[model samples]
Target chain A: MLIIGEKINSTRQRINRALISKDSHYIQQVAVDQVANGAQVLDVNCGINIKNEPELMSWLVRIVQEKVKVSLVIDSPNPDALEAGLKVHQGSAIVNSITAEKNRYEKILPLVKKYQAKVIALTIDEKGMPRTARERFDLAKKLVKVTAEHGIPAKDVYIDSLVHPVSTEPQQVTEFLEALRLIKTLPDVQTICGLSNVSFGLPNRSLLNATFVAMVLCSGLDAAIIDPTDKSIRSAIKAAEALLNRDQYCASYIAAHRESKL
Target chain B: MIDPKQIAENLINGQAPKVKELVEQALKDGLTPGQILKEGLIEGMNVVGTRFKANEFYIPEVLVAARAMHAGMDILKPLLAKSGDKPTVKFMIGTVKGDLHDIGKNLVGMMMEGAGFEVIDVGIDVSPEKFVEAVKEKKPHVVGMSALLTTTMPSIKTSIEALKSAGVRDKTKILIGGAPITENFAQEVGADGYAPDAASAVDKARELLQQR
Candidate 1:
């Protein structure tokens, strides 16, 4: 699975305080820490309330890129902020989101094509969050079609079958898994989600999140946004990958154990 | 008659909107606000808390249930205030000095609030002096401190000392928690109690109040 580290977001109070204080060293440390913990990609969000988002996004991109060579997921709801990060990014980055809402494709797809970046398409539209698997599949299909029209390859698009908090709707996990299975049937389109969303508002969230990584693998999910530094999550991911036959002879798993021991 | 039991069931299921609607409906049906609050919302959260203690409900479930309970509380708070009904239990909480990790702390505060405590949140990276000041002003029944980093765990001890110096150590129960904190460490730091997670924190607060 592609592990996108999620610790740098401004939603986190520490990161938010750090960003507000222009604490570059703190930001750099978090960036380095996430990469060191096995994140292949880092998800950066400037949070929702910060003013001067475009500038902050650019600054964050520069600082993180300075400390690490891992690919970035420039996460934002604003097209201008996405463009700002793209301008500063040294390589092909992933646009963390664009929904199926009308006018989103027109605003964000151009940036993806111009920058040659992958995009995460949220399975939501003007009608609001899709409550059923059929709605999710239909929205994901629309996302693939729209991005393809923008000259982006099918593989460059990641369908995020949004995970609703299961406590609110008991069937939410099942609905999301079913949606992911349907989205996987699309030609070459990848599927991903913020795996933590499923366990939101619950106790012992890490256990639930770790279990979700294993479940999503069977549902054709190729990536997740999570705290890669969490040992339980890391162990679960390694074990799940091994159990699923993705870790070839358990070489990586054995190596991981050996490294931890040392 | 609007069934308050239905509200409790909805809250346990994490149905915030439904809980809100049902609470409004119950009020419209002339059910006492106190009855709706205690028997309906608090009763539901008690079940959630019990399930959480048993590891049957995880963080997400507790959060959603808390949110659902909050929906009912939002309706009752103003009415309760007008009627001059204050929560019997009070707690002041913060992440320890140099520790900006508050997700765990916030969870504990929410659970405490759901259990009918008046929680005064001091936010993250709170200094010892600041904690002393809050203790003096808030005069809470309990004080809770959280630290996620091992390096910052000593702040719990330092803050407790500050409380002792301020002549308020015996006035309240001091509880400590976080990723790195343990019951042994809590003893070393002279804290009255330690809860590994948010659910137990609520129960601990209740027990501390009983001791008081």
Candidate 2:
């Protein structure tokens, strides 16, 4: 039930525009609107194309935290930028990721261990992803065991079960759901899914995606890669939790409704 | 009794090679995906999300972890799909006219899917006429509109106007968002709801649909 806001990343057109033009005002608003609408974490991606990622990450962190009390998810693929952002982080934070690739781990995990920050672990490895649930689960456990050697506990890590575009294989969806159900049982782990990847190349994708999310939670996914900007999907999660008895006494449901009329 | 903290640390330090293997090992050893996800994965992401909200996890990290989680789901999705399950509800969404921004729209779309709702994304640059047409054809319980520009923000209003004109507005709930959008704007434009971020979007969508 943790909502990590995905806006404010430089990959988006507007943020990219803001980065290109050095438009601090527009960048600040991305922080503003997302926070106002109830984003607990503002994700800051300075874009792979930008030159000054560290400085931008620092600046974005300062601006967003200034506006709201929410934590920041400083995301980037560059190890240098991720570390640079980590250097300036004022409070508790999550390191966006660590993968099974040796280079990825060699580059990323030490920082996470150094900072004791929570990390997102992808099930993929050096070559690519496994084709079956058994292989996937094996990799996830390997990550847990390997990271434990670094003194980071398994509980501190989150496993991202990747969601591939459905356009490639219809049966993959079925495979995905099965893995999701099984993933919930991993020792001291949380399962997060990048929800958008499923509909890539399909028509009327949003609907297909929303429907898919509702179906997956039966496996008890912990977090999602989602826009804090979309209400329909948010509404769906809240409603499902309430109806499914995940939210005791419907407290979250009522609060969600009330907070918005604001 | 679950220690989300320890699990999170193991993940951060690369104790696990991949989240999927960790999950399966947990299952074989009698741990549940729900337990692992909640105590470890979810708990760890909570740490990540909290840091994200606090400006601690930078863009690369979020993207990386998001990629990681996407990787994990490649293992998890099929299992969940056939777990003798059913979708909680159904909704349709699309980007409003004159706007090509879709990352946000797409994220929300996926969250809904994760939450077990039927979501239809009509793609970017969707028009009001298209909105009405889809509503009629799909007969969805809810409709979502996205606009990233103040200039294009009007398309959200216009789409609703189209829905109202088509007399199908009342039959479906409408939600709105984008950079220039706000709660007041959502109301003014006649949307029943608005989500500021993708996580809450799923929460909102769930609440609204359940109300009906």
For this target, which candidate reaches the highest lDDT against the unseen true structure? 1
lDDT of 1 at A11: 59
DockQ of each: 0.15, 0.01
Error of 2 at B189 (Å): 44
Per-model TM-score on C-alpha atoms: 0.61, 0.54
Pairing residues by index, what is the TM-score of model 2?
Answer: 0.54
CAPRI-style class, candidate 2: incorrect
lDDT of each: 0.87, 0.70
Q: Which 10-residue window of candidate 2 chain A scores lowest in summed lDDT?
A: A164-173
lDDT of 1 at B64: 84
Backbone collision count in every prediction?
10, 168
Which digits, one per residue and each the tens of the lDDT, describe model 2 over residues A100-178? 8777787888888887777888787755666677667777888887788777887788787667666544566777777
Clashes of 1: 10
lDDT tens per residue, model 1, B1-212: 78999999999999999999999999999998888988899889888988887878777677888899999999999998887786877899999886655568878888888788889999988999999999999999999999975447778889999999999999999999987677877898899999988889988888888897
Which stretch of 10 consecutive residues in model 1 chain B shows the poorest summed lDDT? B148-157
| CAPRI-style docking class of model 1 based on DockQ | incorrect
Q: Looking at model 1 chain A, which ten-residue stretch has the lowest summed lDDT?
A: A45-54
| List of clashing residue pairs for candidate 1 | A200-B60, A201-B59, A201-B60, A201-B63, A202-B58, A202-B59, A202-B60, A202-B61, A203-B58, A203-B59
